[model samples]
Target: MSTFLSALAGGALIGTSAALLLILNGRIAGISGITAGAVMPLSRDTPWRWAFLAGLLLGPVLYRLAFGAWPVVQLDAPWSLVVLGGLLVGYGTRLGGGCTSGHGVCGLARLSPRSIAAVATFMAAAAGTVFLVRHGGW
Candidate 1:
C-alpha cells in the first residue's frame, strides 16, 4: 500500500482500538498510562494491561511477517542523546498529565478542552524544537 493509505489504515486502527478499550474496559487507551500500569501493575488490571502491551509489541512483528521485511528505523542521534530524549519525554508526559496518544487521540475524540490545549501545546513545542534543531544549529 501507499504511504498515505498505510497511515490512514494505521490511524483507523488506533481509533478503533481506543474506542474499543473505552467501551469494553472503561479505560482510556493512553499508551504511557498503559505502559506504566504494566510496569507497576495493580492486581485487578495487570492482565489487560499486559495484553495491551503485548499487542503493541506484536504490531511490528505482524507487519514484518506480512511485508517480508521489518520497517527501517534510522536513528541519527547517539545512544546517550536517545536515552536523554526518552527521559525528557517521560518527565514532560508527567508534567503534561498525559502523552500524545492520550491527549491527541483519545482525549480529542472525547472533545475535551484540556486535551485541545494540551495538543496545541505539544504541537507548538514540537514545531519550536524542530525549528531550533534545523535552523538554530541545535
Candidate 2:
C-alpha cells in the first residue's frame, strides 16, 4: 500500500477502536491512563486494560506475521536521548492530564474545549521544536 493509504487506514482503525471503547466500556482510549491503571494495584478494570495493552504490543508482530516482514523503525537519536524523551513524554502526559490519543482523538471528537486547547498547545510546541531543530540550529 502507498504511504498515504496506509496512514489513512491506520487512522481509521484508531478512531474506530476509540469509539468502540467509549461505546462499549464507557472509557476513553487513553494509553497512558490505561497503562497506569494496569500497573497500579489490581482492580475490576485491570483485565481489560491489560488486554488492551497486550493488543498494542502485538500489533507489529501480527503485521509481520501477515506481511512477511516486521514494520520498519528508524531512530536517529542516541539510546540515551530516546530514553530521556520517553520519560519526558510520560511526565508530560501526567502533567497534561492525558496523552495525544485521549485529547487529540477522543476528546476532540466529543467537541471538548479543553481538548481543543490541549491539541493546539501540542501542535504549536511540536512545530516550534521542529523549527528550532531544523532552522534555529538547535
Candidate 3:
C-alpha cells in the first residue's frame, strides 16, 4: 500500500545517504561522532567537520520544506528526562566506542566484531526498554 511504499522509499533514501557519506567522505554518518568531532575537533580537522555537522542540523528543515511534513515522534517524558536520555546516549556512545550508525551500518557492513557486539547490545537494550515502558513492567 501507500504506507509500505513510503517506508521503502524512506529506507532506500537513508541507505543511499549512508552509502554516499561513507564512500565520498570516508566517514560513517554517525550524528554523535560527527557532533563530537565538530565540538572538539583537532587542530587540523575542523572546517569540514563543522560543515558536515551543519548539513546534519539543516537536513530535516530542508526535508520538511520539500515534503510539507516532518516525521512526528511524541514522547510522554518531560524535557528534563529527554535531556537526561541524550546525556546517557552520549555516554554510552563513548563507552561503546561508537554510535549506532557507525557500528550498525558502516562497521557491521565491514564485518567488525566490535561493531557487531555494539549493535546487538543496542538492539537488546532498546527492545528491553520498550517492553518495560509499554507492556512488561515499568
- lDDT (Cα, tens digit) per residue for candidate 3, span 1-138: 389998898767767877998788777777678777778875676677788777777877987998888867678997987998899899899778788778876788789998998999999998998798789766
Candidate 1 vs candidate 3, TM-score winner: 1
Cα lDDT tens digits for candidate 2, 36-119: 788883567798898999999999999999899999998798798789879988888878878789888888999999989988
TM-score of 1: 0.92
TM-score of each predicted structure versus truth: 0.92, 0.91, 0.83
The alpha-carbon deviation from the true structure for residue 133 of candidate 1, after best TM-score superposition, in angstroms, is 0.9
Model 1 misplaced regions, further than 4 Å: none
Poorly placed runs, candidate 3 (over 4 Å): none
Pairs with backbone N, CA or C atoms under 3 Å apart (clashes), candidate 2: none
Model 1 global lDDT (CA atoms, 0 to 1) = 0.89
Candidate 1 residue lDDT tens string, 52-125: 98998899999899989998899898899899889988878867878889998998998999999999998999
Q: Which candidate gets the maximum TM-score versus the true structure?
A: 1
Ranking by lDDT: 1, 2, 3
Model 3 lowest lDDT segment of ten? 40-49
Q: Flag clash pairs in model 3.
A: none
Better of 2 and 3 by TM-score: 2
